[model samples]
Target: MPTKTDEERVPNFGYAGFRLDAPDASVAWNLQRGRSGQNATGDALPHNPTAQTPRRGAPPPPLRVSNPKVLNYLDDRCRVHKETINLCKSVLQRKSIDWISVQRNDMSNPIHDVDLVISVGGDGTLLRASHFLNSSIPVLGVNSDPTCPDEVDELTDEFDARRSTGHLCAATAANFEQILDATLDGSRQPSELSRISVKLNGLQLPTYALNDILVSHPCPASVSRFSFRKRSNTGESSHLINCRSSGLRVATPAGSTAAMLSAGGFVMPISSHELQYMIREPISPRDADKPLLHGLVKQGQHILVVWYNEEGAVYFDGSHVMHSIQHGDTLEISSDAPILKVILPENLLKQGS
Candidate 1:
């Protein structure tokens, strides 16, 4: 029998909490609509700038109904999320394990020293943690609020929408202890998922995307303009093609089933190293031949995009972290990024297999 390597052991644990656990998050969420009502001038402004402005003396519009049932449902979800974290903590305490906890927003805290990272939320939590990890560390996602089977038949769509899908999470509060024990005892092996590397103006970005990157205008309503070309592994180059669209997305195989799939991109196998690209809502001249709107970027190949929009931005793993792209800035996406080691559930592993 072979001995377990250091990578296979879980000596130190790093736990990551999600948004709802952050300080004042619930309060902010409750006040979000009120905050958006008026600017500093106290004038009632239309939610859409283009909409007709109300008279200065007119009474403010009636507040939308604060659905009590929906509010209770959301509150219960938050409670479940917090309780799940508490349960995990209790287990760690009972076992006398060494661990450290950090909020998802706390990027300054170093989590690299841990042998295994645990995300106590949904896929979003795991994705955020992945930004801070290297290929050496393995991460386990714990779904804090998984939907119950009974709720599916009884709950309304609005209530159902509040539950965490936990697509990337292998464990929920119900099975966390068992899964963690198996992981610590080396009974489970981690899966290596490829990531997407990005470069801006020839300099590599500090953050690698475990999911996908969205490049678009700063304003969602504005069109995105850019020119892209592919450089193959053999040094062959494709002609630069211009595009006008809502945005462009480059996704890893791990991310292909996400926004890429929703955007009409094919879902690649989880083990694939290739990256997929898709242009969103492209605009073509009348009778003009359609340019390369979507394609795969194989390993060792790179895609270079030159920004043509005056104010554009690149979003990583969602809308959380973004960087401005000035006109003429060059953005490059490649498969040369580091791989992420993830502990998938038995079902997910079987699916990937």
Candidate 2:
């Protein structure tokens, strides 16, 4: 047997992506009962006497889909996603690469030891995978299903509504092989994205957020009440400011293009180390001056927030991981977190472009 040369040996990679379809038992049961008069498990449901009666001025019932396979076939997004995954796997196998596949939602998967991580879905999949990763390993995001120009401009009922934006993905099925080769050969450079370091009552959180953190009431309709103050590097503190708003968001530069931009936050340079906070829908006081709604948290500075709500939660990255807080609890957010190494397109790293 011939020994493999250094060039022939490939680094171990961890693969993660979204499933083509998530099976919902309740949805399947409803579809089966509505169309075939039987539940998903093949049990007949009791028939209602007035089920066929049409109410005046009522909206029509939703179209029932009895065959999930047919639905999947008609959905171009699912087909494209599956094809992309297959293509990626074929390329890896052809190159004799060492890799391991793991479910994106499984937090217990051992992914830290891998040399590189490849996320095969849209930005959501990459974000979920990032939750389990540290700064040591670099990640490459592949947009499994990219939207075409025709699809975006056409206004037709036949168009699929579930297309992926893939804002964070730098490669698609067409360019996956070339990009992967470049990444493995040291020709491609990875960007270091700063993360937010969070502390609850002085105890640091184990996970850092590459995107943004949302501090809000558990119920979306309820107001978020909190008091916050800025503490400088020299330990000097600013005056406490109370706020009643929908929520508060603190984002790193990498996350500025996402929810932060939608909420009127500034889009910082991708390489910036600063963290910005934005107050969402603040209820202003008519008698007092306008509150400091948004500001930047530089290195060596941190924001301290005192939760006043009976029950509140802090969401990291997206809605995946969260921590609960009660009244009198303190939460601290800073820019002093570990950095995440990601392979990004050159255009995405440009300042103010």
> Which of the numbered candidates is closest to the native, going by highest lDDT?
1
lDDT of 1 by residue, 1-353 (tens): 11432223211211224422111111001101223464322235456767665789886555443455544555466556557766876777677466543334445433455677777777777887788788987888888777677776676553443356677788888998998888778897789998988899999988889899999998989999988888987889777778888988999888988999987888887878899998888887223325467888898899989999888998999987788899999988899998999888776687678
Question: Residue-wise lDDT of candidate 2 within 94-172, one digit each (tens)?
Answer: 8745654434433443245566777777777777767767788777888876767775566234333345567777788
- lDDT of candidate 1 at residue 221, scale 0 to 100: 93
**Model 2: CA > 4 A from native:** 1-74, 156-162, 286-291
Alpha-carbon shift of residue 236 in model 2 (angstroms): 2.4
TM-score for each prediction? 0.80, 0.78
Give residue 99's error in model 1 in angstroms. 1.2
lDDT of 2: 0.71
Please, what is the whole-model Cα lDDT of each candidate in the order they appear?
Answer: 0.72, 0.71
